[model samples]
Target: MSTRRAFAAACLAACLAACLPWYSVSAQDVRANGQKQPPVSSRGRLPVTGCAGQPISDIIVITQPPFTERLPTRLEWVRRTVRKTHANTRDEVVRRFLLMKIGEACNQIQRAESERILRAQPFLVDARIRVFDDEAGGVRLEVETRDDFSMIFEPTVQSKSPLVRGMRFGDSNLGGSATLAAINWRDGRAYNDVLGVELENYAFGRGRNEFRLSAQRHRFGQDMRLEFVRPYYTDLQRYAWIGSLGGTREPIEFRRGDLPRNALTVRREFANVGAVTRVGPVGRLRLVGASLTREVQRTDEQSLLLTREGVIADTTDVAVPTFRPQRVVRVNALLGVRAIRFVQVQGFDALTGAQDVRVGMQLGLVAGRSILVRQARDRDHFVAANLYGAYGGTRSFVGLQAVTEGRYDRDAKAWDNFVTSGRLAWYFRPAVRQTTVVESEWSAGRDMRVPFQLSLADREGGVMGHRNSRQAGARRLVFRAEQRLVVPTRLNIADVGFAGFAEAGRLWAEQSVPYSISTPWRGAVGVSVLAAVPPRSRRLWRVDFALPVSADPQRRFEVRFSSIDRSRVFWNEPRDVQAGRERTAPSSLFTWP
Candidate 1:
């Protein structure tokens, strides 16, 4: 038999064995026998023990330090000293997130919602809620949570001398207040140096609104932003709003055929404000909203043009296009409907921690008109729409989504800058500790703006082995498949796993000014070593070794490392929607199934 076929056979056999009933005495069986069991709970542990309508006598919050009493004797001093320096999350923070209150009837839905809220906090490692029979004829509620080491300091290194290229340092839970403060510094090649600062508060005020501010400065440009939002914290929340102001002034490098040809300085400033309100029932919701936005952009071609060699070049000889300064003010109406549900699972995205999987359907639409325009184009009408649906079961899940956006120019009598994209994904679990995923995506653009052109790069949905090879285009398609297995770990500090993946993609361009077409299909196969620190962090650290599926002797293997899980396409929780932007369907919808 061939080597690849033999490997596949071995994997199949292992999966079959893992799916069998290996444990003779399961947790449910032990409970049936009236035996004392551990307090630890697994994913989706609902409060269904016939305590749904019981009155809550008292509410208790228990916060655990990072290091517990279950350590070895020799490390007692180390654990004690670390605990003394690291502050545990405050009880008030946990209490404010709870939906259940004392003296009120304990509802199972409220208890489940409260647990999900606590688990979503950045400082929390895990959270659990339990109900007990009270001595005074009412049920008592307990909220138990563990804290993570909130301080982070990561550095980027290179193989050459002066190894350190950049670094990021931050505190995710500043003073146990659930506030984030971070700073980043990078050694830029063309820009000389870069520095940035960011601050965010998840619970800003009495209403627990969110606030964020960021600023970055480099030799070539600077960016500054400020935002405040009051999001729907729960499925039944009635109203939400957001406001933001930001601007950017940066040098943009124009490339052709994957080679830098010219550069120009572009300046842009924008202000936006929006609001949304829920109008339908609790399980299925209809959202209505509106936004007003103003934006201005300008290009500076008079500035010295730099060529690929970093030498001043004549402006007349440059091949890059220069857009006229423009200003636009727009008002948009938004509408959406959603009916979604969540299920907690393990060994899917994270090796050990529970991951919330979202399932159901959502649809959204945004229609707007430019009320005012200056300098360049006449008033235009724009529209955007998105649709998403998913189905998740015990052993399998399937999801599909599509998005389209475009604008109609009144003067040109044609569509301008129209773009559309779609994605389909499927996940299957044959064993308790194993998962397999297959995903495909495609995107196309017509009359696209220069700065919005697409590219086939690692960060832009391309093969890992060809990350450094830039293949720009107006249309792209990619297919990916991966299999993951989690290994048992004896240590409590970390969880380890392994993954094997394959990817293939191609790109095509119509107008060749900004990007060139990549006619040949590129493919890669790779293996990854995955590990998560503190086990419950829900963040994977990966090291990948990829090789191109080609016979070219010039191609070599590539090694890449990343902290983000790029393969995860869907999330259980809704992402925060930015002001003046169309809400991402399914991901930003608020509803319960």
Candidate 2:
């Protein structure tokens, strides 16, 4: 047999031997209340475990000064050479993103959160913190961080016929100050070209505050955005004050391919301020006030407003008539309240290079009214509620999230439901380097119109095996279960190996569309290869070949490519976390000051 085949045979034998239930429990949970808990499986703890009358020691945080640094690897050097530049992130800059401090009580969850928060920074590769015994009875922690090449210049281009393109220049670390600045361009043929610049200072000198400024030109319109944040400056980090201002002219397209020609134009000028206070230990509450002036320009294109089935002609074969164009300008005020709590479960270490469970949940309420919309407005008053939570453990991961909103129309004296959507994901590792995932998404409401409706299937990759899921739906429910088996590492070429997987999902919708799983349930069996792309640690590249069990001609055996395993939900770039590791689906839009 050839080398690859021989390696495959060896891998299968090794995996077969490694496959039994390897979950051997150890280390019972220890509570800080000085109480001894019962052991697992009806197995009682040995009587008088330690010296009688001895009290359990409490855990406190300590830092071992004189940290050791690992210099950049040769691979990093090669990257800099190729890019024609070199960049290093300073130690102090890494300290700014840490959520922990010296002299505080040691909380494993917080430690994990700190590591995760550190990893979230674009300039850092990862943070590694280790806990050790302290001579003084408290636990001490040592920290080490790996850095990423922080300065980059990106130019986005398109071959053949394309509509949008841009170029960007940025430095994640400027003079070791943890400041980020970028100048970019977003050129479009019909909507006017855009040139923009943005700057952000994570923290200036001795103040624990941050500030940001951005300005852009759209030819027909110019816009600017600014923000100021004072975290610890407000009340020893117990209170925070954040303020922002924005003015912009933007466009909303109506049809998938009818952009520029059929769209609504919007002009917005707004200011927002928020006050935040710590709630107890692991929670926080915030209130915000916002004021804005909004201008909306309407359009009356019959084709643009057509239903999913498209517009139909009259019985006499005459085309339908289009509505008259209308315009509206208004002033609005908004009040928002939000609360967040972090609950950590003592279990496993999966993503953040730390051993602690971090589950997060947030609740939000927003109320808004258009003072000038008066009688002709359908969105005179609005209220919304949002919730988000995610958990990641060494062997498993889960996420639960939802958001709902409603509006009260003064002209009609009635309440209109906007939309409500929720998602649930569960993952488990059946064996080493093996993964299984089950996930579902449900969205429902009366106002689920196009551009705001639920997407039926993900065509970005054939993980769901559905060839066509382009139609949007007012109500949608989709689910999938998939499994993967990784090849042994020894039988690889250049850190490359192959895997076999099978995935199947069903989509349910209100329309009698071809995308629904009710017809065939979108099943697929596939084989794929996963290999580490070096010059970067543990970054992987994947290619899949799938054979669909459906009758859709387009669903036949096809090839798909992705950066990571299709089973993961590591919301950030796959490069953010190590390969074959489980992690929470990150909420990337929000960043801490």
Candidate 3:
């Protein structure tokens, strides 16, 4: 068949399929007239898992609705025309983003992966893939897409906290590709105003590379960054690299008032280079190196303590570190093995693990040295290591990660300044659409990494509470359990439906800090409404509510009505196939964003 004729036939078939109930094609069977049906792999193929390839003889692009500004139709149309004219996300970019080509087999794994990746773009709101029967006995891959409003003008005055104010004006989808550019400014009564601007391109080099530039001005100081990444840069199709240079100048606030105003100012600069590659079939390796420099600037002010007179008083007890400049080198390593099973999905986003092996494991090592750069005590060689393991199935998922760091001093002749962190989690679905998850986490050390700290405060991260106080522990442990009820509904709203949850956690250190911990575990209970998100969203929506389990002297109740799910994968199998997936690439920052 001719190319155009083949596409025309595919279009006709797509029209038919679109009109049919989605469930109608869930399974394939032989026709009574001895016609063979496409073979259906009994294995489950979740969108998150991967895609299967069917030979493609044709390709189709289906553009869906656009998020036009609410301006008059004429104005919006003109705006859209201008935007589209300069769009880097043209049909060419979309084709470049696909793992499957016109002459190649239609890979469902890459199909879903591409859809998921595109959805993450700031400019795209929806991306869906469908395969149709072609006239040449080949498959036709159809990609349906919708673009988000590229430009946004946001002005805000937030009083939810202490009468804070802020505004952001930017175009998230600059030049039509997954590029972002915007300006943000905000301030409060203390002149705590912040101004920042950023430009990012996720589709540089046809989506295999990225470039970013950012600058921020804070009330106390400023920050800036320049980054570039070549996501896949190897003939083995198993390696990638990233380079970044950034710096920050900021103030650190201490608990005591005697430190005076801006008594200490910290400036830090760093440059990083990292690479990751698949070792064997199931194992992968990563190496990262960085050079860092730090300097401190201090000023003295009236000590807020007076004997009796109304004059500025002075009580001398607090001592500040001698201002110093330091430089160091940092290195990190990660290795992991992973395996997953795909079960046949019978319904929309339905997952059921038929007895199958699904597991993941990872190990990491970090090293720091300043001997080459500066002869400083703090820069002595230090090493950190971490391990993680997990198992997941349709109804259950469990995982744990542990880390430890220390430095061996020649004079001490032993490893000292040890720090540790660990986390464990288990989830089970007892019935259709119902899941119960239990999790525990802890951190402590003479010197701990940023993530090791126990976070019981509502602002610590995702876990919920009523207040906003961040506390740390030398060795702290927290326990959490929650139940999610998946209502039998589909679409963007209330997909899994709802959840009722209870959480309890505590933070304690080798040395106690006031208001940092309590003898009893702090517990809270709340409920939420979940949306049926594309596999990308993990089918979650707004948190709805997170309340304190009891009353406390500190009204530190923290509450958030919205939640956006960004998954992080510790150990991922490099093989992208449930069927024909592009080799899975580990994210540079978090997992899928």
Candidate 4:
């Protein structure tokens, strides 16, 4: 079949499945068909359990009237007519009747649910109801308060502890100049100086409400230098308020503060504040809120226009680009129904063109398995799906993942194209209680792509910014594979584990691109030994040896890896260099086991 036709079929299937009733156990009831049951009294009650305080006899009555007098009495007759019938058709008759009865009962119960709820709450002394002149079926209740109303708006008690820690190590140049140096707290040692100092508190008021206020400051270097970075001193203050009205299902939060990632000097000056409220029935409420913020960005001085040869030329001149504070309203919803005892949902909205929104959902199935769906809509829309499942025990697992996204071009009136990618990891015992693992990833897009890890220059010169080469003319494909191993305990005196991995793959720049030279292929091999350490600390050290067999556009083959963290070394041409000039890269010490 054609690609278009295949895609259409998949979309149809997803829509149909989503529209079906998610959870209705009555349809699946089979006991009524195979066995007899005791009758209930006219007053409506169930067999009691535990004690009298449980009010077991006062079970919520859910009986309803029959829709049709001629409806069949047999279990089979009921199954076929109910809106949601049991998957097993053996008790088709009874399942159908029970479902219809449930629908009618829900309507009657919903009508008087509020009154029933008020009587159920033992703390309520009295309540007042008010209705708006323009609205119907919308009743507002004011729980009479005896204390001050300001106390009711206070914040709730919450976990507000902030942790900060850092470490430093250095080996001085020996042989020629070895002299005692003063402890300046610059070459590491001051664990607290490199990280930061943070204090937070969430105090509650007499009305049983709470709010949080926090502040933090950090110094990057011992000298507290302000070069390169705009702010020499960083200060941030945050505030969040939460209160629960007696009639509401959950606490309503009034947050006048910054998001975790929005910590910046400009944000503190402008200040962003918002409130969120739930909009669903009891036990289920969607969050609706808004925030106002000012965004600031620094531009390189080289990018600025300069006079050269009496003509304007691009020059780098740092300038802070500040935008007026803008208000962005956001709203989202979530729903939960116990079927597999898991829930999945999504929501997104940006009140105006100046803002954007994104959403994601996930479903966890029985066992260690899960499915995820995510989408982001801003300047463009992108969607992806992934699945994760674990099968092996400690130190081993078989993982499979896949994702695809499309970038839409408004001016072109069409999506640039869709890119699909997938990866698989399989582990096996290669030695006594030891293991060797193999993994591979593949991606295909519009003639310009490579595996994520192989994008050596992604930080500054990623594939997306490549200079024009011939159009290559069709979709491209990139593939990569790696195998790693762990040695047995007998290999080392201390029983330390050994691991090694090698990877190789090809990049197809175009449908016609040759699998050989035209498509750059590379391979790498590395080995490391892990030492055992204390249970609560990751201070365990590792020594690694890696050789890069692939040559970059610079025509250099390198062989270098680091200890502790793989950031201070690089392989370049004929030299294995130590990159101590600056932070060359983030520590690659955290990887999945």
Candidate 5:
């Protein structure tokens, strides 16, 4: 009845016809059968197949001479792009023709040198050509063609350039912490806020080759702080030296978050030097590497004997001079084989091997696949057996882990047993249909205690039902589901998305703790909405909001919001309640970070 309906009907009909499996004999075949037939071409080929074996008759005319340029351009690229691949039949030929035009347009953007040559030779205007012949050998088609062209000017390289500049800046925040297995925060507060900016230049003039640079300020959280790394080497071989002059803050060694709160803040100036080498994708794989950084800290006169609270009676006072060894050695090596694409069997070993001699080794297969990816279909999956018998982290035990990324972040921490894990995800259309993901992790090993409650009570200050020597073997299973909604691109922002999730887990630690992993096979469900906010421009924005109903006693309910920076109600800004009084959870945390 209407134009739109009529168009839809036409499209449907065309698609149905194209998809049908139909074969009809050609007129020539019919004729040879003594019925009736069409006339064959003079050359014993189809009329459309004229010049099936001859060379080109016309020259491929071009207006300019092709020359090497800093980047590619449009015109010279147009000639180099004629695809020789076969377009099987009539329909395919038409489709390939259209695609070739589109490819030419893309080349116009990617070929800078071609455009440069065309500009230099304004006399070279447009291009035209014709195919001379095409022949088939078995299933493949071979094409022959030719063209003539001309240009206006000669090319030159501006190698006399004296200098080039490079600069970059980055900022990051470490906003949450887990003490053992418990979240640590009253109001959400970021522990690490770091921003770094650097500017340097490369001088490429004759024999005077070396990098000369300087900088002002840089700092790294409460632990390690430094202002700059000047006199740094840019050479690619062995024995390259770099120097730095800035204030330094050393990180506490040989401990997890298990340290006393009465720690001293020591500050001083320092310098560092190092060297490195690699054989493959810089960040993906490596064959050999070593780095040695030494920092000489400066300090005013100070005392060394540290005392504990209230239990001290006598005092020894003296202004004793102090200096600390702020030096570290980090060496890593890869043996056998290593690469990004091909399978490489490799072994890695690293050691700081000093006072806090920490050694770690991981021997496992890291393969790439399209498992649990988002919209695009490819990612990394690793089944690894990692061992960390360091002062920090838990003591010695070989652990197994199976991890998948690009959809969800599974167990980053290792488990001390054989573990089986899987994740499934689908990225759906935004605004209407949303993405859904399901994930699980299961493990079996020697017996150990599985947590039920992180804190025994607000007054007890310990875990609930905790045993000193609990056997650790069990079939632990955790299942999680997540659904994400992409905020409509038709809305104010394009990249923002929302999500809702639920998690349930159970562990069978010998029939006693069966059907439950931590506490009563607990499940929690929550929803989140996101908005985009660009970092540098106020015009571009990103924002996300989430409300979680958690079974963890300490965190019964949570409301989270994030933009360029993140903020949460439970961790950043916690709502306090009376010990015995129970009230309905509030809709939001109005005063949180």
Candidate 6:
């Protein structure tokens, strides 16, 4: 037993060490001739005063491979091997995304927009566009881009005996074409076996439409989706459209107090098509669109037995009032206004990568009428509204988002599944390398007709140490705050950082359920080690150690590893509105224009 304990400890230590940031001498430390190098000034934008209206004389494209020759000699072999296998992005691919052309007059706004679009690509680490005087008196434009390590391999592990849980492998830039193809597989105690595949291309054809296809097979069922979209790729574009079809057949379980109380096999199918056009000036824009949607849902009577407190409990008799069969066709009108703005910053979400933060206000509303199939007289009216606003500068950022959606059944003459949610986030940088973030989220549901619920668990609303805590309810309130400090290092391969955080949340449910409205707030405190492969991957690798504030000794310590920073909030582009979805669908508050 002693020897086995020693072996386990060694294995755990090795695993943790492997996840740490790799350390090496910075490229600026020494010159090629072995002489100490001088520090360089910070990078800033070039002057655009006289070059704004000048006609472009020439266009030059420069691409950098992931591993450069400036690194130490010890990595020469690895660099050479990677370069041989990894294809540099095609010149045409970069040129096609550019808004400027030879002999065309240069505009600073277009140039800036081009840079933002190029940086948005997952395959590129950084992008810069500059204008200079040419020998022929015309302005010359230079575009430079650095490639990210396109190939990716991510694995999940646990602290238990079966340490290896799952893995995903893929190429974000297949053959330098800006295409993505990936596969994922997982088998673990908390989850059923899953296998999935995904394919996506942002520049599918001549118009640069986006295309995506995905399929997943679970132990009990499967799901598939296909989507094609011509998004507002640029602010100057006047039109956008989207078409999607998806279906799923799977078993869903409803749990309370860490145990499943009911299970049902559900099958659903949906299709949506929408189009929107810009309707106002560039400074103040309005979006108008309409969509048609069809949805069908069915559930099987068979119920799966689940274990409860070490005993198998037959859940067939459990009442699952949420699963109701329905077929509906709907039409919706979408209206939105945008006054959005952006600011570029470093070390906010991505360690050393350039990040664009969105600010200002965006509002959207969707109103629709649904016709129940096979029951011609049955009808319903639905409405959804989203609001987002933010203010960001060099030192501080504050954002607010809110959304509400529901349907009014004509027959019942009452509101069904009326739900509302809101979140507020604030970020403050006290020093150059230190940041503090605070966020609060609240959600409430009334007359809920579906199995949409909220929880204070880590994966749900993030009460860190209570990952498996099963406090769930129809009303939830959560608050989280974190402070982070970057540790300067010589290594160019990665950036390291440390953070401390505190989280508290409460859940409220009806008396008939396994929870109470008077449940006290639960809290946790934790520390994390954060690392990022700079100028390459956008994700941060994190390891957290947390402790619950409650009196349960068995839940004294909790450890977790993840690729995402839960404390940080990111800005996502607005999406087209669709109809016939439940109020519990993922909120578009932060994503709608």
Taking all chains together, each candidate's TM-score versus the true structure is: 0.82, 0.57, 0.65, 0.31, 0.29, 0.83
Backbone clashes in each candidate structure, one number apiece? 0, 0, 18, 21, 49, 0
Candidate 3 lDDT, tens digit per residue, 237-344?
Answer: 355567776656654332222233212345565666666555554224343333232222222332333212322433545543332243445444434333322222
In candidate 6, which residue pairs clash? none
For candidate 5, write residues 1-593 as lDDT tens digits.
34334334433443343333322221121222576343222343222332233332211211111221212343434424311111111111111111122112222111221222111111111112222222332111111111111111112223354222112221010000000011111111122222222222121121111222222222222212222221111111122223333333422111101222121224443333332243444213332322222223323233222233221222333222232222211121211122111111100000000011112221222211123323322222222221112111212112122321111112323222123232222212222334454545444322111111111111111112121212122344555566655554532112355567776544344432212233345345666554332101111122223222334433334333222211011011111111101111111101100
Per-residue CA lDDT of model 4 for 437-514, tens digit only, reads: 565655444311111111322211112212111122122233333333323442211224455656554444443211
If both were scored by lDDT, which would come out higher, candidate 2 or candidate 5? Answer: 2
lDDT of 3 at 351: 20
Q: Any runs in candidate 2 off by more than 4 Å, and if so which?
A: 1-84, 98-116, 129-142, 149-237, 240-242, 245-271, 283-357, 360-362, 368-379, 389-392, 448-470, 481-593
What's the C-alpha lDDT at position 323 in model 1? Answer: 54
TM-score of 3: 0.65
Q: In model 4, which regions exceed 4 Å deviation?
A: 1-384, 389-396, 403-412, 416-422, 430-432, 442-454, 457-495, 506-519, 535-541, 551-593
RMSD of 5: 26.7
lDDT score, candidate 2, position 485: 53
Query: How do the candidates rank by TM-score, highest first?
Result: 6, 1, 3, 2, 4, 5
| Model 1 Cα lDDT, one tens digit per residue, 1-593 | 34334334433443342233312111111233777444333234334364578889766667776655444566467667756666666655677778877889988878887787676665676788888777567777777887767666879899997799998887666666666677778887665477777677777774446777777765577777677877665665688777887777776654354344455677777777877898888768888998776767777755354543354754554355555454667787878787877676665666666656668888777777888555424477778887789898758988887777877877678876677777788889999878898988887766643244455453546666665554556677888899998888755556788999998888787672355565577788999998876665666788888888743233457898887532234522111011112222222222222
Per-model CA lDDT versus the true structure = 0.66, 0.44, 0.48, 0.24, 0.24, 0.66
